[model samples]
Target: MPETNLPASKTSFVKGFDKWNIAVASGFYNQKIDYMIEEKKQELDEKNRKYIYKMLTFSLLIAFILFAISLYVSTYLEKYFLKYRKKIYKEVEKNKKKDILLAHQSKMVAMGEMMENIAHQWRQPLSIITTCASGMQLNKQLGLLT
Candidate 1:
């Protein structure tokens, strides 16, 4: 056996140390990436919730406004209808009064015509009776009524 002197090298140990350091850095990077992803998810969820709330509020406001408009319109129409009905009642009453007046005037005209006819029928008989009474009186005075 020949004895030869050689320098001690730490290449293997240095290589193993480098490998360990690389593994640790990789693990830290993976952890940081996971944390950033979780933050982004939470932010997206908050934005979605705000948008839904705003939409709901807007929809409710529109519905309330429509209901108020309908109520006002219905009340206005009812008031107008009542006024028209009152006017119609007044007109009907006026017509009825006019009809009664016309009936009374017609009855008066008919009565006047009937009275004139009765007077015309009695005139001739009354004149005949008067002539007979005067003749009798004259004969009695001359003594020829025996």
Candidate 2:
């Protein structure tokens, strides 16, 4: 099975996280590892308890600050999006206008070709009409064009 990046909330983690510790909400994500180390230290004899506890506390504090900084960054990005959203929208419109102009140029070229073909088709008939008119005028001058 593929390893999914599901949140620690879904998958099992250390006892601290399983108990819904504040560290998880603070978003350090590494605090889970700290808690795991604490759990392993639980099996140790005596000297490790205070040290592990201090480590967990330090990890929690760092995680909280990291989460706060992350929140600030995300909020900054959101504000930037709000500020520049209209400019991005205008760029999209400009690109669309350019596409439409290109399409129009292509259509005009096709239309010019179609018109040229029509002129060519009509050229022979027009010439025939002029010739017949000239012949009739000559006949009339000879008294037969009426």
The prediction achieving the highest lDDT against the true structure is: 2
Query: Which runs in model 2 stand beyond 4 Å of their true positions?
Result: 1-54, 78-89, 139-146
Q: Over the stretch 25-70, how does candidate 2's per-residue lDDT look in tens digits?
A: 2333455667788887776735577778889999999999999999
TM-score of candidate 1 on Cα atoms, chains taken together: 0.49
Cand. 2 Cα-lDDT = 0.80
Each prediction's whole-model lDDT (CA): 0.76, 0.80
Error of 1 at 72 (Å): 1.5
Q: Pick the candidate with the highest TM-score.
A: 1
lDDT tens digits, residue span 12-92, model 1: 222235655542222224444566999999999899899899899999999999999999999999999999999999999
The worst-scoring run of ten residues by lDDT in candidate 1 lies at: 7-16
TM-score of each: 0.49, 0.46
How many clashes show up in model 1?
0
